[model samples]
Target: MTKFDEQYRDLVFRAIVDGERVVDRTGVGTRKLFGETMRFNLQEEFPAPTLKKLFFESAKKEMFWIYQDQSNDVRLLREKYGVKVWDEWEQKDGTIGHAYGYIIEKHKQIDKLIQGLKENPHGRRHIISLWDIEELPYMSLQPCAFQTIWSVNRGKLNCQLVQRSGDLGLGVPFNTAQYAILVHMVAQCAGLEVGELLHTITDAHVYDNHVEPLKEMLFRPIMRDVKPQLHITNRTQNFYDFLPNDIRLLGYDSHPQIKLEVAV
Candidate 1:
């Protein structure tokens, strides 16, 4: 198991043992902690949790839908990539409205981000945010892992993801590995080496329905001897050129997937 898997297990344990039980917007409720952070050195190994299987293909396709496709159409995601995670939130017009990819496309955020990273590696202003207060009302669901800050150090590229809220059981694992892959892709496009991925969550919680399964995950034996790694097969100089097949995960051994309910 990766250090991240250990940390993830610890975080879940903390929530069960020390988190406050509270009602949330979902009505499913949560055992929540106010603030939490996880850091991974991309140079050592990938940060995917192995206690339960991660849907790597789905996560990769979703990331592409958000950044590369920059599309708000959930139908396109389903038809093109065979990913239906966003279908639950698909609006009447067959889209997620002005959330996520819409905002990115509108503001040309991804283009500017890639350009900024390439031109000014040491620039402190490298940031991308999906939370547009004005457009929030039209969105089916606001971006959860919404902001990213990029920094370059000693020929390495690092990313800090700031999430306003994270569902500990489901969303956290996907976001953790998803963003790590993003960092790797962006780093490659910028002609830099992989460095670190730092994730910060303002409100991290496990829904009431997920506590037991998470407990089961925490107690399961971890494959400590196995090491998981991420491989980027595409050397696409532009981040937008990346396709779902361009990335691959190697040495990912894990237990059976644990089913959990999404509070949405």
Candidate 2:
């Protein structure tokens, strides 16, 4: 089982306040373009908050919906998981172009990424691009302005996420957890072990509307008992063969939920 600490939360808080203050006082949004830098060495610890219950299955399903579907239609997500977070972005034709799911649905890309890991394990350039600038006009929120790079070294998989803008308090937590799981999934499929996750955000700002809620979270004490453990079965070479139950998280404990607003 893995327990997340307050170090990331505190660092992100500072980055958001400082970045937002700079943009407010200087009228320059560049600070938002260049986000904050943070890293999580999974080898040292798994980064799930000890304060609130983090749902691992939900995170895994969401990731499956995005990269696996090749369609960003919220209805599909709702059908499988009953989540409508992207309902507003649904198109009239009942299709949402290569949002996150679209890329995963592509056969060539997935094969290439897997092959890259096996052939070039030490290369940091093993990246899976979700946001295509050319397709931005068709997207709803453009899948977090971040790009992800995943690599493997000495049988350990490492992941790095580079973001142009981030709503640190709300988005970062989910993004971090979900992507961390993604790294786990990829590593499992690639026959490798989990390593570290390095998250770097450019404009890591807590939305103006979420400031108070964040303050409230900071005041509450973290629940230290809940630990996260990953369970993966079916040692198959094909990533697509992985089912929902193939990977599981056991014994996750946390405090009450904290509500926060999103900038969208």
What are the clash counts of all predictions, listed in order? Answer: 1, 13
Global lDDT of model 1: 0.90
- Off by more than 4 A, model 2: 1-3, 15-17, 22-34, 104-107
- Candidate 1 lDDT over 46-165, as tens digits, reads 888889998999998989998889999999999999998888888899999899999999899988887998899899999999999999999999999999999999999999999999
Residue 227 displacement in candidate 1 (angstroms): 1.3
| Candidate 2 residue lDDT tens string, 1-264 | 233456656654575455535443223331232545667766555577755456556777777776555456677788977765566567776556555666455535666777888887887678777667776677655667357788777789888887766666656667777777777777876788888887887666655555666666666676666556666686777777877778676656666667764334
Error of 1 at 139 (Å): 0.5
Clashing pairs in 1: 1-223
Q: Candidate 2: lDDT of 54?
A: 60
Query: Which regions of candidate 1 are displaced past 4 Å?
Result: none
| Shift of residue 152 alpha carbon in model 2, Å | 2.1
Worst 10-residue lDDT window for candidate 2 reads 24-33
* lDDT assessment of candidate 2: 0.66
